[model samples]
Target chain A: MYEFDYRRPNTLDEALEALRTAPDGKLLAGGQTLLPTLKQRLANPSDLIDLAHIQDLKGISVEGDTLVIGAMTRHAEVATSPDVRARIPALAELAGDIGDRQVRNRGTIGGSIANNDPAADYPAACLGLNATITTDRREIGADDFFTDLFETALVEDEVVVAVRFPVPVRAAYMKFKNPASRYAIVGVFVAQNSDGVRVAVTGAGASGVFRVPEMEAALAADFATGAIEGIAVPQDDLNSDIHASAEYRAHLVGVMARRAVAACG
Target chain B: MTVTVSMTVNGEVVSGEVEPRTLLVQFLRDQLRLTGTHIGCDTSQCGACVVHVDGVSVKSCTMLAVQAENAAITTIEGLADGERLHPMQEAFRENHGLQCGYCTPGMVMSAIDLVRDRPDITEDEIRKGIDGNLCRCTGYHNIVKSIKAGAQAMKG
Candidate 1:
């Protein structure tokens, strides 16, 4: 790893100040992704603003009808939090299945969403549940927050503070995971709420996580696994790799969507 | 740039000056000379570098030394008491949970944390729980048995 200045700040304001001073600074949440990137020399930030000491960005709470999770809360914490499990069991299940035990112990939701890895699980949860992402500067809806592959609406130096998820009536996520890394080869999150049904697919999309409107409309009508039985996901935009071909991914998306809906019960 | 990192390792409070880029595993093996914690894969995929940071297992190779500041860390060297090995260690030894033993320290650490979190961890759960740790010898059958035995011994 290359040499860099490290600043462990105790407050959000102090972290923002440090980011402002160091033009090439990266915020270290749990050091799950950033540290690996640094180790591989994929990134060379001048300074690292460590946010682990910030007390404001760690907790799980319920306010009104929404479940609010502080960004810095680790995946392990989310997986085991009673509040999270009671409010949104699907979200808890998703958190419990990410990566592995040690990875979950150190990986944060903020880092996961901010990185926007196409194979990441949190993006599916965010989009499927219509979450609201609150950053230090402003609030961005889940639909608009994820802009592209490995991208988000967040600009430079903007720290994601929290994510607010509306508790769905019933929701579940299923994935055809790559056995080695446990990364989603093709994953789907299905949710039925007051508004309607939402079906989000991740790891398969060429751009990033996206909703299947047709499947959503069908499920909204019947709210059953059979609702999306014959609805074919277009293969044009799905990802293709050694793990799975684009056609296979498109096929698995339908299979996973049904599985998620079935698991919702 | 060099930074001063202070943390409690095993039960000892230790501090050292290291480069900002120094990994936690490097700090342990080089500076502290606690070489029991092996580095199987420099990448985070292999769990040979697993250790307890604030009582939770994490990959030390992926964490910077400075990030462990003031944190309580428990490595393989800290698991045994004087001459008596930890129950998990004893179980591994008795069950023949290893072949080459390259991944034993990390596997033992991960198993301890898993059993500590859930004393009633089943065989299926134990298999899934140790996903991060890889034994090249493919000796997981014995490893799982050791963890089950270890969990029972811990209750005693």
Candidate 2:
């Protein structure tokens, strides 16, 4: 790795100040993504502001109908938290299935959502469940959080503080994971809330994670696997790669959505 | 430039001044000479560099040594009680959990945390627990067996 200055700030204020002062500075949460990017020379930051020391960035809490998870909360914490599992079992299950134990243990929710990897699992949960992403600057809804491939609503120096997932009536996530990388080749998260039914697809979209309105409408009325039968997403909107074709991915969106609904049941 | 970091490693309080860019994995292996915590992939994909931070397993490869200041860490080297091997370690040996043994330490460390956190672990749970740790040799069959055996042994 290239040499760079490292600072471990105890408080978010100090960290934010350091980020403000430093040119091309990157915040280090779990380093599951950042470290790899650094090693591959994909990112060359002048300084690394380690956020692990900031106490406020960790922990999981349940407030009535919402599950408030700190930005820096490890995937393992979310996956295993009694409160999260009891309240949002699908969210917990989603956390548990992300990139194995080491990744879950080290990868933070903030890092995953921030990186916005097209194949990441959390974005689907965030979009499908209609979670609220709280940053130091302001709160962004899940619908607006994800913008495009490797893009998010967060601006530079705006740190994610927490993600508030409203307790859904029923929800589940299903993914066809790439065996080697464990990334989702095609994943779907089906959620039914008071607002209505929401279907989020990840690892299959060109614009990263996205929701399916047609599937949502079908499920909202019936909430059954057969509700979305023959509902094919457009191939142009889906992702194509060595693992799967765009058409295959489009087909998988329906199949995975069905599985997610069945699992939710 | 160096930063002073104070943290507990395997129940031992240790403090040192290290280069700002030094990784936590380097600190444990180079500074402390705890070689059991191997570095398989420089990237975070391989679980060979896993260790516990405040009782949670994290990829040391991704974290800087300075990030661990004042934190509690438990590496594979600290899992045993001097002469006696940790149950997970013993189970790996008995079940042939490893082939090259490069990923064994990390697998064992992750498994220990998994079993401790969920005592009622099932086969599927065990499979998902060590999903991060990759063993190209065993195809994860024997590794799963080792974790199950270790969980049973730790229960007693």
Candidate 3:
């Protein structure tokens, strides 16, 4: 952790101004990831723009059929919010299961999605539920928002305002967690929305979180765990480490997808 | 770059000058001389530095001192009366929840927050609640018992 300037902005406008002033500045959300990255000397930014003080960037509200969660809304709030539980229980359950109780108290969905960690749980929910990410300038669809591993479509100094999650008819996120770190070894999010059935897989893909059209198509025909029976994601491009093999990850993807679909019903 | 941060800790307003990279845990243990919070891992995986930031349990090591400016922080030292131990601490003593006690401060802090959030939580919920606080001594069985008893004591 090298010495650098820290700025606490009380408003989004002030935060944006701070970012504009410091080109190499990094936004501090819950600091669940960013601070640890600094402690390990993995990254060194010239300045840190802390968004913890912005009151406007925190809240949960329902707009029509969408659940608009402010970017800085803590995971604990989302997990316990009555609106979230009543509207989308699966999303709330996913929020509850992320990291741990202490982590949930501080970690935010916006920070989770913005970081775009390959093993993170929020990206699967965002992409699977087809949530819309709203920035200071414009709104970006989840499909377009996530670009690569630890990367997003956000431009320089772009500030995330909120994420609009369209209430799904039925959705569930299931993950095979790595015991030690609690990161998803292979996580699958299955959703039945007005548009169609959508399935997103995280942790296993080499290119990061991705959609499985084949599972989606199968689930669309029959909304049951049996619908995706015998379906398997290819193992070649998946991640393989000491925790799990690529082949095992591909297998767990199928297992988690089936479990998620079953959990929905 | 040095920065000045002031915050309410254990009901006392404390101010300190520290580097921008100074962690909340470092500020408490080094500057404020509150040594109850431990730092087991710098990677944020270990919850030995868990503390309440504005009434929420967070890993202090993962938060900057500057970030916690003007926030209300409650460390392990704030949990009890002058002489009497907090119910959670008493439960730990009665149940022998710790062996080496290296992770006790963080484990107790996390447990208190867990009970504060969900008072009627079950055994499975209690197990899941303290997942962030890892005890290397493998004394989780008694720790779980302690939390359940502590939650009951909190009610009484």
Candidate 4:
């Protein structure tokens, strides 16, 4: 690993200041991704702005119908938090199923969403449930927050503070994860609310996480596993690799959607 | 540039000057000479470097040494009390949980944390909870037995 300056700030203002002052700074949340990337020399930022010490950027709370989670909140906390489990059990279960226990102990939802990994689980939850991402500057809706593969609406020096997830009437996430890394090969999140039904698919899209209008519409009409039993997404845009074929992924999307719907009950 | 990072390791206040790129496993094995912590895989998938940071199991290889500053780290060396082995270690020994012993240290460390956090940890839970710690010796049956016994012992 290459040498770099490390900055640990105790306050949100200080962390933002550090990011602003550095020549090329990377915000360190759980360091589950950044540290490994740094070790491999994939990213060589001039400085690392450690967000672990920031006070306000940690915790989980329920405000009426929404669950507000701090950016620095670790995946382990989200998985085990009583408040989150009570409010959004499916979200908690998704958090619990992320890359093994050791990884979850250090990985954060904010970091996971901020990185916006195409295979990550949190993006599906955020998009499927229509969460609001609150950055240090402004609030960005879930639909607009994720722009592309490993990308977000966040600009340089813009730190994500918290994400607010509206509790759905009934929701669940099911993923066909890669056994080795536990990354989703084709994951589907089924969410139903008063607004309507939102079905999000991750680890399949060529660009990133996206909603399936057909599946959403079908599920909205019936809100059951049988409704989307025959759902078929385009195979041309899904991911195809040694582990799975694009056609297989499209098939799995339908299968996972059914499972997720069944799980919602 | 190197920085001084101080943390409580195995109940000892240890401080070391390391580069920002220094992983906690490297700091323990190379700098602190606590070689009980092993580095098995490069991609951080193998949990041979698993250790407790502030009472939670985490991959030491995936965390920078600077990040462990002011945190309490429990490595394989910290499990034993003087001459006696920790209950988890004893259970592993009694159950023949290791073959080559390469993954034992990390396996035991992870098991202790698993039982500590989840008291009623089932066999299925143990399989899932210790999913991070991979045993290349290919001895998972005894490892599961050891964890169940160790968890019960820890409760006693």
Measured by DockQ, the strongest candidate is: 4
What lDDT does candidate 3 reach at residue B121? 74
Clashing pairs in 4: none
Report the CA-based lDDT of candidate 4 relative to the real structure.
Answer: 0.92
lDDT of every model, 2 decimals = 0.93, 0.90, 0.92, 0.92
lDDT of 1 by residue, A1-265 (tens): 7879999999999999999999699999888889988888999999999999898999999999999999999999999999989989999999999999999999999999999999999999999999999999899999999999999999987999999999999999998899998999998999998799899989999999999999999998898889899999889999989999999999999899999999998
Off-target runs (Cα >4 Å) in candidate 4 are B117-119
lDDT of 3 by residue, A90-125 (tens): 999999988888778889988999999999999999
lDDT of 1 by residue, B1-156 (tens): 588999999999999999989999999999999998999885699899999999999999989899999999999999899999999999999999999999999999999999994668899999999999999895699999999999998988
At residue A127, give the lDDT of candidate 4: 96
User: For residues A1-265, what per-residue lDDT tens digits would candidate 4 score against the true structure?
Assistant: 7778999899989998999999999899988888888778898899989999887999999999999999999998999999989988999999999999999999999899999999999999999999999999999999999999999999998999999999999999999999999999989998997699999999998889999999888887898888987779999888888989999999999999999999999
Candidates sorted by TM-score, descending order? 1, 4, 3, 2
Which pairs in model 1 have colliding backbones? none
lDDT of 3 at A195: 97
How good is model 3 by TM-score? 0.98
Tell me how candidate 3 scores on lDDT: 0.92
Stretches > 4 Å off in candidate 3: B117-120
Could you give the CAPRI-style class of model 4? Answer: high
Error of 3 at A249 (Å): 0.7
> Model 2, B122: alpha-carbon shift in Å?
3.2
Compute DockQ for each candidate against the true complex: 0.88, 0.71, 0.89, 0.89
